[model samples]
Target: MKKVLKVIGITVLSFIALIIILLSFLLIKNYLDSKKPIIEDTYYKNFQSDATLEKKYAGLGSYEVSLVKLKSEDDTIKEYKIWYPTELKSKSQAYPLIVVTNASNTAASVYESFFERLASWGFIVVGNEDKQAGTGLTTSKTLDYVLELNSDSDSIFYGKVSQDNIGVIGYSQGGAGAIRAVTEYDNSNKYKTIFTGSAAYSLLAKNMGWEYDISKVAIPYFMSAGTGSSDDSGEDSKTSFGGVAPLSSLIVNYDGIRNDVFKVRARINGAEHGDMLTRADGYMTAWMLYQLQNDEEARLVFIGKSAEILSNSNWQDIEKNN
Candidate 1:
């Protein structure tokens, strides 16, 4: 009887120890995740071009911003938002459309600043209103809805939006889905390009049974990541850009580089998982303007003195290959 009690005590002690170890492991993991590098304004304080940020529109000028919300019980974009340039009064030009959603899966309201920035630059930016970032289907649906609107001749936006100049942008998992969307939905390649920030879906996508090829995408691919230690997006961008000579050509998105057909990879300093989602600053703005509008001044930022400005500010690495 004494031996039996001793065995029971030993088993109880062993179970208690296991529980302690599990709790400790969880605590450590939580602590480490909280330490991932994040963008802080102080990080850019010493930058030489910090002075320019104070000027209007990050020195790119501005436009009147407008918002449209779509919310219905039967709509895919239930409670979504669309930010666009309102200065198209009595105009007849089809503007490029840029769609942005968060991998964070929050409402479009959470990313107002980023969308506003894109819209101010004269691109129609749409975001899903729901927290459905898991599949990225809704993001595509948002684009389809806008395209449908553009076809309505009686609608205010009829013939005012370009069908071929669409760009899909997102961060983390949302970014991966955006990349996949280029091949999955737009099979004919309606989208002129793709821009993803830190989407390492090589593992997650497969686990979820979403098999996609990064190489099949033939459009201009622009990817950015932080040199920080965390593999937040599964290193999908880094791996894709570094996988092969033909697969990944490194070139900085600059003037005259586009005519040559190149891929761009930008490494940013102190950019955490959420920086681009909230504030990609002049970098994304310049890239979009260059890609969609063929804005020369915007091109200068990526390839000219303004490039120096960002170099002075926070960009650690910006290179591309054709």
Candidate 2:
């Protein structure tokens, strides 16, 4: 009887050991997956022509900006900011409009660099003031306010905001809001593209019952994040980007020069969540120019020669759904 008992104990101990080994292996694999692959400097050089590169990456456009205190009826967007070219009125055609939401516990002005940079690219960027982490009501409200301004002949954006092109962007909580904007509000013309920076993951979404399936979104979506803890350690960004169908090229019908989808991961090795507030100069703009303006140089950065450069880096985990 004692021999039988000893045999049973050994079997149980062995089973536990095997379980621990399996768990340790999985943890190691996940850690490796989150790491940068390798470094290649030649592939990292500026790949665009002098003129095109300057136009998209330089942020040198002479654009003026304005800020407004919104009324109480504005849902969640209590305040807003606008950045437009000083020459907006001089142009015959309307310019694109892009709306932005801020990270939780911060205000719209915190992302002033983000809005102003996109504006320098010739889009009318509207930054929303929101503090809530779980709700995106503010994101949709920004566009609604733009529509109102565009319709009001007395308003500054009247006849100046292009209805055909619109963009939504956000960071952290606002990143989640940007996703909610299109998935919940569902407007094709107003939300032509969505770029999320270090988006809040499902845990936060679950707390508010605000989570939505990424598969439901049909537009071009780009997810950018830092592997650092500041960017949620790419926690949600990984899951979000991975959830989408790699057939995004067919879904959004991006330009014919590329065969891959518009959706992919831009995992910067050293970047953090708040770093997006001031940096992300070329990384974010390239996606916008590629999607909104169909800029060839920007497209090249995504899937062109510049992309070839990025593929050689071990500091970034650039992946697409497959």
TM-score of each: 0.69, 0.68
lDDT, residue 316, model 2: 57
Give the TM-score (vs. native) of candidate 2. 0.68
Best by lDDT: 1
Task: Evaluate residue 286 in candidate 1 and report its C-alpha lDDT on the 0 to 100 scale.
Answer: 63
lDDT of 2 by residue, 201-256 (tens): 54455455557455555677777666555554323332453221122211231222
Clashes of each: 11, 5
**1-322 in candidate 1: lDDT tens per residue?**
9999999999999999999999999999976754443333233332233534322234333677788786745464676577778876467888899877556545566546567656877888888755545456677677777788889877667888888688878676676567667767753266787777766445455455444466566777777766454433333444443221111222322332344554666666666655544334556666677788887765555564345434544655566543
Q: Cα miss at 107, model 1 (Å)?
A: 2.0
The residue pairs that clash in candidate 2, if any, are 36-314, 37-314, 38-314, 43-309, 249-261
